[model samples]
Target: MFARSLGWIVLLGLTLQSVQARDYRYSDAHLHYVDFFQESEGMDALLKAMDQARIDQSMISGVAVAKKWHEDEPKRPRYYAGDDADAYWYSATDIYVAAALEKLEPRQRQRFHPFLTGFNPVDKNAVAHIERMLELYPGLWQGIGEVFTRHDDLTALTSGDTPRANNEAMTRIYHLAAEQDLPVLIHSNITSKRERNPLYLAEIEEPLRNHPHTRFIWAHAGSSMEIHRHQTRLDFLLPTLSRLLESYPNLYIDLSWSVLQPYLLDEQGKPRAQWLALVKRFPERFMLGSDVVGRFDSLSEQLHGFDPFLDALPADVAQKVARDNFLAVLPKQR
Candidate 1:
C-alpha cells in the first residue's frame, strides 16, 4: 500500500506544476492551542511544529480534554486534568472562541466544559464554577472535547459506566451554539473498545441530532487515545470513522497527528489506505494537522517538517485541505 500510495503521490506531485504556489497560510482547522493542563502541552508543541511545517495559520483553541479523568474518578476528589475549567489551565480560551462572534449568553450560554477527575473541585458547584470562569474571563472558552478517553489500566479501576455530566449542559452547549450559529467539536468514540466505552458521546449525539443547524467536528479522526498494547490501530479506527462519517453529515473530522507513520498502520501490520482515500474523496470533511509536540529540531532531517507532507500533496488538493474548506464554514478573521 505504501508503494502504491508513494507512486500516486509522486505522480500527483509531478503533474502539479503549481504546487509551490499553493503554499500559503495553510490554516489548520483544529489545534490544541493552549496547554491549560500542561499535561500534553500539545498547544505550544503544535505551534512550533507549524512554524517548522510552514503552516501559516490555524483555528486553534483550548479544549476540555478530560472525559476519561472524570469517569475514572467518579468519587471523592474530581480530577480535572489538562486545564479546562481552571483559571490557570491555559492562557485564554474564552477570547479565542468568542473572538469574532457577537453576543454571548450569560451563565449556561458561556460556560466552559466541565472536566472533573481525581482532583476536581467537586460537583458541589461545577456549573457555577465554570460560569464564574466565563463571567471573569468572557469570550475565552468555546465548548468542550478533544476530551481524552482511553482504555488504560489505572483508569479502568475508576472510570464511570455512564455519561458523567447532565444532559442539560450538553443541551445548553448546543443551544448556545445554535443561538450563535456556531459549531461544537466533540471527542466521539470511533474505534471499537470494550474496555473504554464513550458513553458521553451518546449525550453529545442526542443534542447534535436534535439540532440539525448546529455543526460539530469530531477530533483525532473520531478515535481518541487508546491502549495499543499490541493491538492493531487502523484496524479499529478507519472503519469506525468511516461509519460515523457515513452516519452524520454535520459530523466532520480533522486529520491532526495521523500524518506520521504510526497512524497509517493497522494491528495486522497492514498499511491502511482507507484514511488517505477518505481525504481524497472528501477533502472538505478532513483538516490537516501535524500532531508533533515541541519543535522541528525534535525530529530533524529524515522527516524535516510539516511542509514535505503538505508539499507532497497535489497543489489544489493541498490548498483545500490546508484552509479553504475549513474557513468556508468556520468563524474567521483577517
Candidate 2:
C-alpha cells in the first residue's frame, strides 16, 4: 500500500511538470500545407489547430515533390510519400499554399509564414522558377524548402534528376535565398535507412561550407521516421551534430517528430543527456517541427513531444527553442 502511494506521487509530480512545460506557447519551425498525394488539408483546419494548441506562428510549405506510384506494386502504401516509385516535382503544390494564405483574414495571415517549394533542386532553371514565384507573390514566401534530397527509397525512385544538396542548381538557389534574406529548410537525409551509415554526409556538409551567408535549417537534423525504424539508436548523431554546430554559425537544426524517439529521448521517454546537453550548448541554434503533412489532428502531440526536454532546460533556453529560435530565423515582414 505504501509503495503504491509512492508511485502515484511520482506520477502526479511528472504530470504537473508536463503541464508547466506546455503552458508556454510555440512557433512551429516546420509545417506542411499539403500532403504527399497533392491534397489540401485546408487552412481552416490548421488555424483551428493552432488556436486550440495556442501556437503563435507556423512556418508552412507544400510538399516539394509528389510521391510516384509504383506500377509493380499490388497495393500502394498509405502514410509515407516514398514508399513506392519516383517522387515527382509537384509545382502546383505551391499554389495550394498560396491559395490557403489568400483564404486567411489579414490578421490571422500574419500568424503563418509560407515557404516556396516544388522546384526541382537539380534543374538549372530552378533558381528562375523561384525568382518568378517571388515576383508573383511579392513578399508572400518567408523561406525556402523542406527541400527533399538524399531521402530514403524516394531517392532510388526519383526520376528526371537525382537531387543533391550541393548540386549546381541548389547552389544557385542558396544564393537566391541569401539575396532574399530567407532561411532555407532542407530535408537531406544523412544516411539511408538500410545502410545506417553516413553515405550522404558530404551532400549537406558542402552546402554548409559554401553558404556562410545563408541560414540553413536542417530538417529532422537529417533524420527520418524510416531511418529511425531501421536503427533506433543514433550513436553517431551527437558527435556529428556537435562538429557541424561548432563549425557553422549559419546552420540550425530542426528537431522534428522523427528525431524525438530514441535520438532525443530514451526508451523510457526521458530526455537523453547528450541531446539535452547539445541543446543547452546551442540554445539559439535549435528548433522544433511537427513535420506534419496535410493534417492538424496530431499537432498537439507533435508540439507536446518536447515538453519533458523543455522542462529540463533553463527557462530562457527553453523559451528560445519553443518559440523564439524559429521566429528569429524567419524573414522579417516587410
Candidate 3:
C-alpha cells in the first residue's frame, strides 16, 4: 500500500510536468515526408525521432493513404511520354534519371513511390489498399496530402485523357478528407522552376475552398531551391506563405527538407537575427515540419527526423515551432 501510494504520487508529478511543458513534441502536424525514401511504417521512425527530441505526439498524413482512397493516383509502374520531350511534367520517366533531368519528367518527378532504388504503387494487387493502410495504422495518420503532384512522365498527369481523369479522382479524394474532417498537408511548392503554381488556378483551389474544414499544408513554403538557397537573409517563402495564409484560414506552412540553409543565409550569405524573426513569426501558422529522412547522419537528416531544425530555434520559439503552434491549429484527431 505504501509503495502503491508512492507510485501514484510519482505518476501524478510526472503527469503534471507533461502538462506543463504542453508536451511540445506532439500536436505537430506538418510532417512533410518522402514516403518514397522512408519505410512504410514511418510512424515508428517518427516516434523514435520525437522521443529523442522529447516530442510527445504528432499529427500525421500520407500520399499512400490519400491515393489508396483516391483511385485516380497514377500507378506506381514506370513508363514514358512520347515526342515533345520538353514537356517532361508528366511525359517521361527514368526513375534513376529524375534528378538528372532538367524538367519534370515522370522519371524525374517526386520519388514518393520511390524513384531512386525502385518504385511501385502501394500494393494494388492486395485487398482494398486504402483499407489496409488505415487498418495497418489507425489513430496515427490524422490526414493526408503533401502528396507531391508528380508523375512517372508528363502524361500520367498531363496526357490528353489521363489528366482529366486524374483531376476528377483527386476531387473525390479531397472530398473524402473533407467528410472525415481531417487536415491535408500537400506537396505544393509555387516557387519551383519545374512546376507551375497550383494555387494560381481556380479548379485546384475549388475543392479546398469548398471544404473549409480541411487543412492544407504546403511542403516547400513556395520557393525554388536555387534562389532561396543562396539568400543572404530573409525568406523568399514569406510572400508565398503569407499570400496563402491570408487567403485561406486553413492554409499552413512546413519547413522540411533543404536543411533550411537558404533561408538561413543573409544578403551577403550570412545568417542573421532578422532571419530568425521571419521564421518565427508564423507560430500557430507554422510547424516544425522536417522531411528529415534516413539518408543523412544527423537526426534532422534521418528519415522522419528534426534535431537539426529544432536546434536552430530559439527556446521560446522552438517550443511553439516544434509543437505548441501546431497543436493550436490542427483539426483535432479523430
Candidate 1 lDDT over 1-334, as tens digits, reads 9999999998988877554444455655555433333334333444466566555654544433222334444443333433222222222443443432224344322222211111111123334544565576454444334433322331233233322222444555456555544555554444344434433445445554776666676656655444243343445455555665676777677655543345644445344466556666666776655433212333222123334444545567667766676565553321
Q: Candidate 2's error at 64, in angstroms?
A: 1.4
Off-target runs (Cα >4 Å) in candidate 2 are: 1-22, 69-77, 80-83
- Give the alpha carbon lDDT tens digit for every residue of 198-308 in model 3: 333343355446666666665555443443344422334445455556677776666654435556443354544544655666556667554432211234333134433
Worst 10 residues of 1 by lDDT: 113-122
lDDT of each: 0.46, 0.87, 0.43
TM-score per candidate, in order? 0.57, 0.90, 0.53
Candidate 2 residue lDDT tens string, 1-334: 9999999999999998767634778999999988888776687888899888778999999987787667887776564553656667889888888988998799999998899988999998999999999999997999999888887767766677788999999999999999999999998988887765777899999999999989999999998887877877667778999999999999999999888887888888998888999999999999989888898988988998888888888888998999999999988654
lDDT of candidate model 2 versus the reference: 0.87
**Of the candidates shown, which would achieve the greatest TM-score relative to the real structure?**
2
Clash counts per candidate, in order, are 24, 1, 32
Clashing pairs in 2: 86-157
Backbone steric clashes in candidate 1, count: 24
